[model samples]
Target: MRHVVAAVAGLIFALGLGISGMTDPGKVIGFLDVGGAWEPALAFVMGGAVVVYALAYRLIVRRPRPVVEVKFSLPTAKKVTTSLVVGSALFGIGWGLGGYCPGPALTSVVSGSWEVGLFVVTMLAGMGLHQVWERLSARGSAAAAPAPAAPLAEGPLKGVDA
Candidate 1:
């Protein structure tokens, strides 16, 4: 049942992207251009999404738990870290350069454009690289951490019966 709901939600989102012309690299690039023949239509789509999410977030938080989950799995991080900054920058750069962020790229795949296919493939490869990097970083941090000191030895006869 949860899976069905998720599929339906994804279908609706993809349809929205397609209907809003977000699946087109040219359209997305036009929006990003900003200086030359900027396309402002997507702004409305984005603004509508923000408004909908704001309302949904408020309503959803009032519920003790989600309909399909035991509890909400929202982000708990409050501090900005280097990894977050770098990841966000990379995502923005990729979106600006390819004019296709992950969602739109996946939706555009059905169009059978080689460029989109290439972008998806590259995106997947980048995800894999990120995983590897994170694992290696975790290992390095663990290795650098100091091991717990050995428990101090009790005085002689400490274990012997009095």
Candidate 2:
């Protein structure tokens, strides 16, 4: 049932992408080329997405928990770290060069374009490399660190163990 729902949703999303000209690398590249032969349609798509997400988030947050989940799985990290900066830079560079991110790249694959195939291949390779790097970093940190001591205070009341 979940798979059926997911497939239907994916099909709808892909249709939207195709209809919106997001599956065309030329259109995306034109959007990125701000100074020369720029296409502003992508901005409208982004703005629509932002508005939808803003309203959806507000609605979702009003609920104590999501209908499909026990709790919201929010990221704990808040700081802008080196990894975040490097990742953002890499993403921006890839988008500028290929004119296709993962979502659009996947959709473009259906168009049977060789450029889309190449972009998807490179994107998969990047994802694999990221997974490998993350595993190695996690192992290194685990091997180098010792467990921290527990907090002196406990429970609802201060300095209480109950």
Clashing pairs in 2: none
Taking all chains together, the TM-score of candidate 2 against the true structure is 0.80
By TM-score, the best candidate is: 1
lDDT tens digits, residue span 70-120, model 2: 786654455666766888798898888877878889987877888888888
Q: Number of backbone collisions per candidate, in order?
A: 0, 0
| Clash-forming residue pairs, model 1 | none
TM-score of each predicted structure versus truth: 0.86, 0.80
| Residue 81, model 1: Cα distance from true site in angstroms | 1.5
CA lDDT, every prediction? 0.80, 0.74
